[model samples]
Target chain A: MITHSNVWRFFTKPLMKTRLAPRRGLNGLAGKDIGDRQSRIIFTVLGFTALTALLLIVLFLFLEGTALFIHPAEDGSRVGLGDFILGSFWYPGYTPPEFGILPLMAASLSVTVLSACLSIPLGMGTALYLSSVAGPRVREWGKPVIELLAAMPSVVLGLVGMMVIAPFMQEWWDVPSGLNMLNASVMLALMAIPTIASIADDALESVPRDLLEASYALGATPLQTLMRTRLPCALSGVGAGIILGLTRAMGETMVVLMCAGGAAQLSFSPLDAVRPMTSTIAAEMGETAVGSSHYSALFAIGITLFLMTFAFNLLASFIAGRYSQKGYQAA
Target chain B: MVNDPNAVEVKTLNFFYGEKQALKNINLDIKRNEITALIGPSGCGKSTFLRLLNRMNDLIAGVRLEGKILLNGMDIYAPEAESADIRRRVGMVFQKPNPFPKSIFNNVAYGPMLHGIKNKHGLNRIVESSLRAAALWEEVKDDLHKSALSLSGGQQQRLCLARALAMEPEVLLMDEPTSALDPISTSKIEELVMDLKNSYTVIIVTHNMQQAARISDKTCFFYMGELIESGATDQIFTLPQQRQTENYITGRFG
Candidate 1:
C-alpha cells in the first residue's frame, strides 16, 4: 500500500473506468410457454355462460318488448305504443278504456320533482353537518348507520311509509284523508336521504386537511373556510349524491304503490291524487287477465318505463362523469 | 403575527407532544431585522422550536407548553391570546412546499382575502408584489391563473414563500425551507433569506450546516432538544464553548 501511494505521487494518477450491465430477471413473460389446455376450456365455458345469460336477457327484452312495435296477433291488434305513450289519459279498463300516457307521465314527473326537491337539500345539509360539523367520534360510527337505511327492503319501506310517514305527513300538514302524490313523494324522499347523505359525506371528507389548515392560518373563520375551501372543493361529490338520491326516488316502486293513489291526472299540486309508472306497473300487473288488451297495454307501459329509466340512467352517468372530470381538473 | 410588534424573549421555554417532551428547557432571544439560524440533527427540536414561534403547534392534539414564550414580554400561551393573529404576524414556510391546490394568483391572494381585503384591484396588486418579492412573479406572471400545484418544487416553494409574504408578517419562520429541494433551489432560498433580513426578522431551522454558516448572523446549535451552544456564527463555528458543541461541530456526534 505504501509503495503504491508513494509511486502515485510521481505522476498524475490514471482515471479508473468501470462498466456493469444491470442484471435482468424473468419479469417479462411474453416468451413463456402456455400450460394446461383444460384451463382454457374452463375459462371459455365460464365466459360463455355469462355471455349467454346476458344475451338471453337482451333477446327476451327485445322480442317481448318489440312485440308492441309489431301488430298483435289476430283479431284486434290496436295502434302501436304511438297512441299509448303520447295520449293524455290512462284508464286501462273501464267502459271506455283510456290509455293515453300524458297524464300519468305528468303525474310521475311531478312526484319525482317534488321528491327531489324535498330530499336533495335535506340530504345535503345533513351530510355536511355530519361530515364537517360533527366530531370524529360521531362520524366514525354514524356513517354506517346512515347507509344502512338505504338497504332496507322496498316492501318494508312501503310498510313504514303507510304506518309512520303517511299519518305524520297528514297530521303535520292538517290536510285530509286518503293516499296521494304528496304522501308518496314525501315517503320516497325519506327513502332517498341515506343515499344522498352517504355519498355527500364521503365527498366532504375527501377535502384536504392541508387546505383547511392553510385557510385557518390565514385567519379565515371556520365557517368561511368550510364554505370557500371545503364545500366548493367537494361540490361534485355532493352533486353525485343528489343524483343517486334522485335515482332512488325515480325508480322506487312499492312505496309509491302503497301511498300514491293510482289515479292518472296532472294536478300541478303535491296534495292531489296521482299515478306514477312504478305504482301503475305494480297495482294492475296482476288484476288484468292473461292475453287481454289491458295486459298487453300494461306491457306497453312496462316498455315505456324501461326506456325512460334507460334514458335517465344514461343522462345521470354522463353528468356524474362530467362533473368528476371538471371538478379535479384544477391541476 | 408581528411578535407583538416587539422583539421576542424566551425564558426556560419547553414543549411536548402528549407525554413526550420535544423541546427541553431552553432560553433564546431573537432580535429584530436579523436572521437567526437553528442548526441541529433530525428530531433535535429545531423545527419544533420554529413551530412554537407562531403557535402553529397548537393545531396538533395533546400539545402542552410550559414556562414562558414571550413576544414583547407578553405571554403568547396566555388564555386570551388569539392564535390566528399570532400565526398571521409570524408567517411560516414549511419543510415541504405546500402550495394550495389553487391558482398562483389565488394562493397569493388567500391571506389578504382572509383578513378581509375586499378591493379586487388592490388584492391583485398585493398578489403581484408578493410574488415579485418572492422572486416568482417573473417566472409565473404570464400564467397567474394556472394551478399552484403545477409548478416545479422550487417554484412551488417560492409560491409558498409568496403566500406567507402576502400576509405582510414582520417575522418569517422557515422550517427546512429547502431540504426537499434541489441544490439550486436551496441556494435561491438562501439568497432570498439574506435579502429578506433587510425588512423582516427571520428564524430558520435547517440541517444544512453550510447554510447556517453562510446566511445566519446568529446561530443556535441544538442537541437532544437542548441549546448546547448559541453565539455569533463565526465564533460558534470556530470556537464553541461547550464540548458537545465542539464535538458536534467537528462531526464527532450529532
Candidate 2:
C-alpha cells in the first residue's frame, strides 16, 4: 500500500484532471449556477440611498437649525437662544430682533391647553359611544366621519377656523370680536377630535369583550362598566390619543397663524390676540435674509417645534405600547 | 337561598339565531341548591340554554326568544324585569378564563365593588374568603397585589371562580369551565363546583361525557337544540330512554 501511493499517483493525476472540463460560460455571474455580483451591489446601493435620503433630511434640518442660535453678524457672537426662548415680546428683526418667547409660549400653551380640555372629554365620550355603546352599523358609519376630520388639510382647517370658530367665539363667549387664543384653541380642538376619537376608540375596542361581559354579569350598568372598567383599561390608549392630539395642537401652524391673533403679547386672556412660535416662524421666515439672526431664529423655531413634537410623539408611543400590553394580557 | 316555587322556571322557551334554531320548546324546572348539568354535542345549544338563566342572551345580536324564563318564582322575562338585577343573582364563569387586568385582590373584590361595597376591610374579607373557598388563597395570599395575569392557566381559572364566588350569587352558571384547563385544573374546578352546591344552585354545560357523569345530579341531554331527555345523572348515563340520548351517552354517536 505504501509503495502504490507514489506509483499510482502519476497515473491518477490525468484521470482526475480531465474527468470534468472547465467551463467559462457564466462571465457576469458569481458562480455558474448562482446570481451575479452586480445584482447584490445594485441592491446594496439602492438600500443605502433610500436610508440616506431620510438621514439627509434630518441632518439638513439640524444644520439649518444651528444658524438659529449662531448670529455671525452681531460682533460675530453666538446669539443666546435663551433670550428668544424666554423673552415675551417675539417681534423678530424689528430694529433688534425682539426675541421674547414667553408671550408666544403663553399663546401656544393657552391654545393647546384649552383645545385639549375641550376635546378630551368630547372625544373620549364619542370613543365610548362608538366602541362600547353603539350598534355595529352606527359604529361603521361614525368611524369614517371622525377619521375624515383628520384627513382634512391644515389650510382648510385654518380657513374653517377663521370662518367658523372665530365668529362663534366672539358671538357666544363674548370674545373681543377678533382673532384670539380661544378661536385658535377651538380650531385645534376640532382638528384634534379625529386623532383623539380614533385612537381612544381603538383603545376601547381593544379591551377584551369578555371583561365587558364580566362587568355586565357582575351587575354593572353600561355607564358603570364604561366608567370603571373600560375607561381604566383604555386609559393608556386614551392618554396616547390625547398626547397625539396635543402635539397636533401645539405644532399647528396655519390655524394658529390666522385665528390666534398674531400679537406678541404675554397674556392669559383667550380673547386677546396672540402670537405662537409656529406663527412667528411662518410669518418671519420669508422676508428675513439668509444668515440674519431672524432667519436662524426661524430655524430655531423649527427646531423647538421639532423637539417638542418629537418628545410628545415619543411619550405617546410609550403610553400606547403600555396600553396595548395591557390589552395583550387581557386578550 | 330564594324561598320560592322553583329556583328557575322556563315555559315554552324557543330561541333562534337568525334562521338557525338553538333551543326548541325548552320547558325546564331548575330546582334550588342542586347541580344540574346540561350535556350536548358542539353547537347543540347547551350553552345557549345556560345563558337564558339570567338573560345573558341579551348580549348577543339578533337573538330571538319566544318564551318566559323565571327566577325565584318571578317572571324574569316580564316587561318590568331588570336583567341586570337578575344577573347579579346569577354569576357566570365562561369556557375560557377571563380575569380583569387588575391585581388578584381586585379581581376577587370586583363583583362586591360593583354592588357598592367600598369598605376596604370588607372587600379584603370578601376577597380572602372567596379565594379560600376556591382553594386559591394559599398559593396567592403572599402577593395579592400582583396581577392576576401572572398566574398559570389553572390558577387564573381558580381566580375567576373566586371572583364569581365573591358576589355570593344564588345561582352559578358555568359554561365548560374546565374545558380549557388541564386535568388537574378540571379536577379542582369539579371539586369547587361540588362544594358550592351546599348553598348555591349550580348549572353547568359540558361536552365531556365523564364530567356530566361525575359532577351532575340531574342531567339534561340536548340534541340539535332540543331537549332529548332529562333525568338523574345515574339514570341518564345508565339507562337513557331516548335512543338518540342513549346513542350519544354510550359512546355510540354525538
Candidate 3:
C-alpha cells in the first residue's frame, strides 16, 4: 500500500539484515568468519614455515660442523676442537692438513673492528645531519639516496673493493698489494654506513618535538641541545645501529673474499694481506673432497660466523627494547 | 604609554606561517611583576602571541613576523639580538609537561650547566633553589636523582617549571600550563602563578576562562586572529565591552 511505516521498513529491513548477519563482500561468497579463519590459517602457516626454515639451517650447520671434531681428515690426521679453533696456522691442503682457524678469526675481527671504528662516527653524523640539521628539501633527496646505497649488491661492492679501492689504497700507503685488511675494512664500512645512518635517523626522528622546544626555551644553543638532549635521548638507538653495522661487517663474505688477500696468516697490521674465515671457505670449498675435514672445518667457520652475528643482533635488540621502554615511560 | 615600566611590550605585531597570517596587528604592554593571561579558543593565536616574546617561534620554519617586541626597552627582534640571549632572559613552560628524559636534578640544573656553572656545589644550590621556587622541592628532594619521567603528570609539569626557573629568567611565559592537569593540579599551578608574579613577570595563555579569571590580574581575549578585548580581569569577566568576549565568557560560543 506504500504506507509510511511500510516504506520505512522496506528501506531499513535489508540494512538490518546485513548488519545482523555475518559480514560479506560484494560477491557474497565467503562470510566474515570464513575469511577470518582463512587469513588466520594462512598467517600461522607462513610464520611456522619461516621458523622451520631458520631452525633447519641452524640444525644443518651444527651437524656438519661437529663432524670435523668427530672424524679424521682424508689424510688420516685429526685435530682437537680447541687446537683447531685457537692454533694460528691454517694450512689445509698440505700433506698433514692443519685446520687451525685462529688466523681466519683474527683477520675477520681486525677487519670488523677497523670498519666499526670508521663507520660509527661517519654514519651517526650522517644520521644526525639528515634528521636534525638538514632542510626538508635536502632530507627528501638525501634519505632515498642513502637507502639506495644499502640496496647495492654486496658482490658489486666486492668488485669495487678489488678494482678501485684496493689499487688506490696500495698506491697511497705504498704497500706491496692493494688487497689487504685496510682495503677490505674500508669497503665493509661503505657497505655498513646506510644501515647505521637510516636506523639512527629513525631513532632521532622519534624524539618528541616538545622536548626540543623545551631545550630551546631553556636558552640552549642548537649544538648544545643536540649534544646534551637529542644525543642522549637517542643513545640506545644509536648503539643498536652501531651493533647492527658491526654485525654486518663481521659476517660479510664477498668483500673479504675478493679483497682481503688470501694469505692465512695472523699479522696484526692493517696493511698486511690476510685471509678471513669466509674467504678461506670460498677459496677452498670447491677443491676440497666432499666429506673431508676441510669441508667440516669450513662449516665450523660458518657456525662461528653465525654465532657472532646472532650475539650482535641480540645486543642490538636489547638496546632497542630499552630505548622503547624509555619512550613509553616518557610518554 | 602607561607610567609603569613594562616588562614586555609588543607593538603592531603581525605573524604569518607561509602565506596564511596567524596573528593580526596586536599591541599590548605587560606590566612588571604581574600576571597577564591571554584566553582564547583553539587556533586563536593566543599561544602564538605568547611565543613571540622569547622568539621561540624562530625554531619553526616558514614563520614570518612584522613589527617589534621589546624586553627591558631593548628590541628583542633587532638584527643584532641573538635568540639564545633573549630566550635566556625569558623562559617558557609548554602546555604539556615535557621533562627531559633525565634525572630531576639534572633537568633543573640543565640551564645553569649550559651557562657554564660547572662547580658541583654551585649546581646543587641552583637546583635546590629552582625546585623550591616551583614548590616541588619537598615532594621530590629525596628522589632528585630519579628519572624526571618517573614523576606524576602534575609533578612533571612543576619540574618543567623548575627547569625554566633554573635560568633565573626575568620574565616567565606559560602557554596553557594547567590545561593538561587535574583540577587539584590546576589550582596548585594557579596559586603558583599568583606567587610567581611577585618575583618574575608572568604571562599565561589559557583556554579555561575560569583559570584566567582566578589567576590573572589582566585578562586578554583573543578571537580568530585578532585581540577582541583586554582589561582588568574583573571588568572583562563582569562587563565585557565586546559581544564576542561576552559570548565566550558566558559560554554561548567559543
Candidate 4:
C-alpha cells in the first residue's frame, strides 16, 4: 500500500531532520551553505597572491645579481667573472677596485659552522629535560619563557653582544676587541637555541607512551629508557629541529652586522674580526651607488645567501623524510 | 585446591586512585606453578589486582595501596624492594599486542640485554629458546631480523609473550592476553598458557567466562571492586556458592 509520497518521505525525511535543526539555520538549510563559497574564493585569492609575491622576489634577485657579469663596470672595464668570484680581497672603494667574494664566503661559512656546533648540543639537552625530566609545573612555566626569548628583537641581542660581550671577551682572552668572529657566533647561537629546543621538545612529547611503558615493564631504569627508547623514536623530529636552528643561524643579519667588527678578511682564528655575507650586504648596501659594480656585487652576495639557505632546507627535508619513514615502518 | 604451596599471597589488599577506591580488601593465594584466572566485567579491578603483583601501578600518579602482597614469602611492598627487581621477577603481557618497534630478535633480547647479557651468541640462544617456548619459533625462525610490527596481530601477541619469557621470570601476568585475537589464535595461546603452567606460575585476567573455565585450575570472580568468590574452576562454574556469582554465570547480568 506504499504510495509515491511515502517513497519520497522515506528518502527526504532524514535530510529534512538534519536541516530542521536550529543550529543549521531557520530556513532549513545547512549553515555551510551560507557564505561558505565566498570565504573559499577569498582565501584562494589571498593564498595565490602570497605565492606570486614570493616568486617575484626570487626572480628580482636573480635579475639584479647577474647584471654584473652581463655588462661593463662604470669605469669602462670588463670585470673578469673568475677573478671577481675566486679572488680573496674585497676593495670596492679603492682605485682599480678588486671585487673577489672568497673572503666574505669564508667568513660566512666559518661563523655558521661554529655557531651550529655551539647550539646543537645545548639546545637538544634543554629539549630532553623539558620533555622527559621536567615536572608538569616546571614545564608549564618554562616553555613560554623560552618562546618569549625567541620573540625578542634580534637587534637587541646584537646591541647586547656589541656592548657587553665584546668588552668581556677583550678582558678575558686579551683579544683586540670583543667584536670578532667568536662574538658573532655566540650571539647567533643564543638566538638559535630557542628554535631548536622548542621544536625538539614537541617531537619528544609526541613519542608514543606505549613504547615507554614497554621499556619500563622490561625492567629498564628511567635513564636507560630515555636514552635507548624515547630518544631514538624522536630522532627525526630532533633532526628537523637542528636544521631549523642552523637555518636561523646562517641567515641572521643584525647580530653578525653589529658584532662582526665589519672587516672583510679571511682568517682561520675565531678571535679575528671577520665579515660574513649577510653582514657584508647589510653594511655596504646603503653606501653603494645605484647601477654600479659594488651594488651588483652586493646583490650577488644575496644570491649566494639564498642558495645556501635553500641547500640547508633541502638537507633538512631529506633527513626528515628518511628518519620518518623508518619511524613509521618500525612503530 | 588450596593444598599447593602459595606462590603469591595477598592479605587484605586495598588500592586507591587519588580519592576513588578501585579495589576493596582482596585476599587470595595463588598456588605454585598453577594457572589462576581472574574473571570480571569491565572496570571490576581485575587488571589492577594483577598489576599489583609486580608493582606496575607504581608508575601512575596519586595511586595508593594498603596491605601486603607477598611473592615467595617475601613482602614485595617493602621499602627496600626495588620495582625493577620485582618487574624482572614478575613479567607481564599487556591486553593489546605491544611488541617493541624492533627486530623480532632484538625484541626478545631486550629484557636480557637490560640484565647485562651482551654476548651475541648468548643473546641468540635466549631469543631462540624463548620464541620456542612461546610456540612461535617455527613461523619466525627464518625472519628473526624482520621488524616485529610487520607480524600479524596474533603473532605479535605471541612475540610479546616470548619477549617476557626471555627474562625467565618466576611468574607471568597476562591481562586479557587473547581478547584481541581471532578464535584460532586464542586457542593456540590457551594451549601455550596451559603448557607454561608446568614451569612458571600463570595469573591471567579475562572477561571471557568460557576461557576462565577451560584453562584455569582455580577461578576468582570479581564484581564492583570486591572478590565475590573463588574456588576450583568446576565447582565455581557448575555450583556457585554466591547468588551474585550464579547471576553473572547464568547471564542474568554482568
Candidate 5:
C-alpha cells in the first residue's frame, strides 16, 4: 500500500531480522556484518598486492643475475664470482671480455659520497631555517615549493646537467670534458636536496616542544637550546633522512648516465669521466643480445643496486624506531 | 634594591595572544622565599602568567606584553636586559616532567655546563648538590650514567627540578609541577616545595584547590584573564571577599 509505517518498517525490517536470525546462511550476506568482512578482506588483499609484486620482481632478478656465473662468454669461458665482482677493468667487448664491475662500483660510490658531502650541509641548513628560524608566513609558502623540487623529473635535471652545467664546468675548471664524476655528483646532489631537506625539516619539527622549553627555562640561548636539546633529540630522524637522500643519489640513473661521460675506468680524481652501475646497465642493456652473458651481467648490476637500497631502507627504519622510543619516554 | 622585600613586583601587566587578551591588568607582589600559588580553572591564564616571568612567552609568535615585571628589583623587560641573564637568575619547572634524553648526570649538569663551569670536579659537585637539593641524589647516585628517560614519572620530575637547581637561580617558577603525577608524587613535590622556601623564592601555578591550601602561603585566584582575589591562603580559603572567589573555593561553581 506504500503507507508511511510500511515504508519505515521496510527500512528497519532487514536490520531487525538480521539481529534475530543471526546465522541464516546466504541470508546473512545481506547484513552489515558480512559487508564489513568483505571490505576487510578486499583491503588486506589490496595492501599485500604491491608486496607480492615486489617479491616476484626480486625472484626474477635473482634468477637472471645468477645466470652470469653459469653462462659462458662468447669464447666459452664462464666468469667466476670473485673475478666478476673485483676485476679491475670492465671492457666487455675485448677478445675475452672482462666483466669485473669494480670500476662501475667505484664510480657509483664516488658520486654518492660526493653528493652526500654537498647535500648534507645544504639540506640540513635549509631544514633548520624552515623548521625553527622562518616565520609562519615564510614557512607556509616556502615548504610546498621545496617539496615541489622533489617532484621534478630526473630526465629534465639530467638535460640541465648535460646542456647547461657541463659547459659551465668545462669553462670554469678548464677540464678536458664537462661530463665527469663531479658534474654527475653536483646534479645528483641537486636531485637529493629536496628529499633530505623535507625529511629533516619534519624530523626537527617533530621534536617535542617541551624539550626546547626546558632548555630555555634553564637559561640557554636559542642557539644553545637548538644545539644541545633539539638537535640531539632529533638526531636519529635526521640521520634517517640523510641515509634516504644518499640512497636516492646512489640509485639515480639518468643524471649520472648523461653527465658522467660514459667512461668505464677507475680513477681517484673527481674530474675523471666514469660510468656507474645503473648507467652501465641502462646504456648497454639495449644493445646486448637476449639470453647472452652481457644481458645476465646487466641484470647482476641491477641486483647489486637493489640489495644496497634495501639495506639502506632497513637501516633508516631501524634508526627511526630505536630513538623515537626514548623521545616518547622523555615527553 | 637590596632592601626590597619582594622577589618579584608586577604592575598593571597585560598579556595578549594576538588580538585576544590572556591576562588583563594583573598587579601582584611575590614575597622573597615564600610560596605563592596562582589558582584558576583551565584556560584562565595561570600558566600564561607563570611563563611571562622567565620570558618563555617570547618563544611564541603573535604574543605581546604591556607594563613592567621586576625581578629582584630589576626590570626584566628592559631593552638592555638580556633574557638569558634573567632566566639564569630565575628557573622554571613545568607540569609534565621533561628530562633531556641524556644520562641522569648529564641532565642535572646541563645548566651548569651552559653557564661555563667546565672543570670536571666543578660539574660533579654542582650536579651532586643540585640532585641532593631536589631529593633525588640518594636514589640515582649509583646510576648517574643511566638515561634520564628510564626514570619513573616522579623521579623524572625531580630530575627536571634538579636540572633547574643546577643553575643556582635565586627564584624558581613552577607551573603545576605535580599535576601530571600520582598522589604519592604530588605529596612528595608538595613537601619539596615547602623545603625549597628556605633556599629559593617560589611562585607556582596550580589547578588543585586543596594543593594550593596545603602548600602555598599566598594564594591568587584568576578568572577569565583577571586576577579576581589574592591574599593569605588561610584567609582566602576560610573567609571570602569576592562572590566569584567564594563560589570557586567552595566548589559551588567554577
Candidate 6:
C-alpha cells in the first residue's frame, strides 16, 4: 500500500510547512535535509579519525617508554624506573651506561624559570600598551605585527640565537662559549612573548567599557582606573597567558638544542651550558637503535615532557575558570 | 546678575558633536537642594544637557561647547577648571547600574580611595553611611565582602547610588537611573531621589512623564534640542503655556 506519492508527501509536507514560516522552515530543513545529514556524518568520521590517531600515538608512546624498565639491556641489566629518573649521571654510550634524568629535568626547570622571569613582565607590559595606550590606528597596525611574531618559525629563532646572540654574549661577558643557559632562555623568552602579549591584550581590551566609564565618572584618573580596575579584572586571563608561555618555553626543542651548549651539568649559574629534557630526546632519538634501552629511555623522557605540559595546561584552565567566574557578571 | 550662592546658571549654552549641533542656545538656573527633572522624547538632548552639567560630554571626542556654565558663581567651563574635580563634586548615576567587579565594600570605598583615604576605619564609616543614605545598608550589611556583581539588579542600582554618594557630591546628575528597573525598584529609587534633594541638588533626565511629575519640583521639557518650557512641575503638567509642551504632555505628539 506504500506508494511514491506517500513518500513524496512525507518529505514535501515538512518542506511546505517550513517554506510557509521562512525562518523556521529554513532551520528545519537545515536540521533534517539529506545533504546536511551526509555532511554531518562525514564531519563526525573526520573528528573520530583525529581522536583515534591521538589515542594510538599515546598508546605507542607508553608501550615503548615502559619497556625500558621491563626489557634487559645489551649488558643484560634491567634499569629500574626510580634509578632511571633519579640517577644524576646520563652516559648512554658508556661501557655501563648511566641514565639518570634528574640533571636534564633540572636544566629544563631552570631555563623555563629564567625565560619566564624575562618574558612575563615584557609580555604583560606589551599587552597593556596594545590594549589601552595605543590609539585605534596604532592598534590596527600593531596587533597584527605582534601576532605575526607568533607565526615566525622556531628554527629561525634558533639560528638567530646561535649566530647573533651567542657571539655577542661570548664577546661581552668573555664566557668560554656563547651557547649557554642564558642564551637559551633569552631565545625561549623571545618565542613566548608573542603568545603572551596577544592573549593578554585580548583580555585587557575585553574589560567592559562600562567599568571604564564608571571609573572615569568616579574622579579616578586614567592610570588609577587601569591599575585598580582593568588589571584586577583581567588577572586570570593574563595569568593563563603567562603559564602558557612558560609551558612553551619549557617544551621548546630547537632553541635549547642550538643555544643551550648541550652540557649535562646540574649548575645554578645562568652562564653554564645545559641540556634540557626536550633537546636530549630530539637530538638522541635518531641515533639510538630501535627497541634498545636507549630508545626506550628517550620515549620515557617524552612521557615526562608530556606530563609536565599537561600539568601546566591544567593549571592554566583552573586559573581561567575559577577567577573568571568570581570576577565579573554583566548585570 | 546678582550671584546666587548655590545654583547652576547656564547662559546661552550650545553644544555640538562633530558637524551636528546636539543642543541649541539655552538659558536656565538649576537651584540647590531641589529636584529638577528633564523630560523629553528620545534624542531630544535632555541627557546631553544633564551630562554637560558634570562635563561628562568632554569624554566624547570632537565635541565642542559655547557659552558659560556657572556653578556657585564660578564658570565651570573655564580652562583652569579640572574635569576630575567637577565630576567628583557633581557625581552621576547612569541609566544602567554599573557596579565595579569588586566587593560591595570596595565598590563604595573606590572614590574615597582614589582621593587617598586609605585608612581602614575611615573607609568602613564611609561605606556604611553611603549605603544607609541609598537605603541599601540593612540588606547588604551582612555581605559587604561579597562581589558587587552578585547583587540583584535593584540592589546593584542602589549600590551604584551609594557609590556616587560616597564621593559626597554637591550635585547629583542621574540619567534615567531607574529606567532599567522593575516597578518596585523604580519606586524605591524614586523615594530615595526625593529624599536626596534635602542634602544635594538633583538634576535628572527621564522619559517617563509620571516619574517627572511625581518627584520633581521643577520640570524642563526639551524638544529637538530646544528647551520648550520650564516651570514648577505642577504648573507645567497642569497648565503648560506652550502649545508643543501641552501637546506632548497630553500625549498628542513627541
Worst 10 contiguous positions by lDDT, candidate 3 chain A? A29-38
Assess the local accuracy of residue A78 in candidate 3 as a C-alpha lDDT between 0 and 100.
Answer: 79
The model with the greatest DockQ is 5
Candidate 3: segments with Cα more than 4 A from true spot: A1-35, A326-331, B1-4
Please provide, for model 5 over B1-254, each residue's C-alpha lDDT reduced to its tens digit, 9 standing for 90 to 100.
87888999999999999999999999999999899999988899999999899999998888999999999889999999998888999999999999988989889988888988899999999999999999999999999988898899999999999999898888899999998999999898999999999999999999899999999999999999999999999999999799999999989876
Give me the displacement of residue A205 in model 6, in angstroms: 1.1
Clashes of each: 4, 4, 0, 0, 0, 2
**After superposition, which runs of candidate 1 have C-alpha atoms over 4 Å from their true positions?**
A1-59, A72-86, A94-99, A171-178, A287-331, B1-6, B72-74, B252-254
Between candidates 4 and 6, name the one with more favorable DockQ. 6
Per-candidate DockQ values are 0.23, 0.42, 0.49, 0.40, 0.55, 0.52
Query: Could you give candidate 3's per-residue lDDT for residues A21-107 as a string of tens digits?
Result: 764566554434544445556679999999999999999999999899899878777779888889888987788888888999999
Q: For residues B1-254, what per-residue lDDT tens digits would candidate 6 score against the true structure?
A: 34464578899999999989999998998889999999988999999999898888887879999999998787889999988888888888999999998899999999999999999999999999999999999999999988898899999999999999999998899999999999999999999999998999999999899999999999999999999899999999999999999999999987
Candidate 4 chain B: 10-residue stretch with minimal lDDT: B1-10
| Model 4 CA deviation exceeding 4 Å by range | A1-37, A75-86, A328-331, B1-4
Error of 6 at A207 (Å): 1.0
Sort by DockQ, best first: what order?
A: 5, 6, 3, 2, 4, 1
Quality of candidate 2's docking, in CAPRI categories?
acceptable
- What's the TM for model 1? 0.84
Displacement of residue B184 (Cα, Å) in model 1 is 2.5
User: Judged by lDDT against the true structure, how good is candidate 6?
Assistant: 0.90
lDDT by candidate, in order shown? 0.79, 0.84, 0.89, 0.89, 0.91, 0.90
List pairs with backbone clashes in candidate 4: none
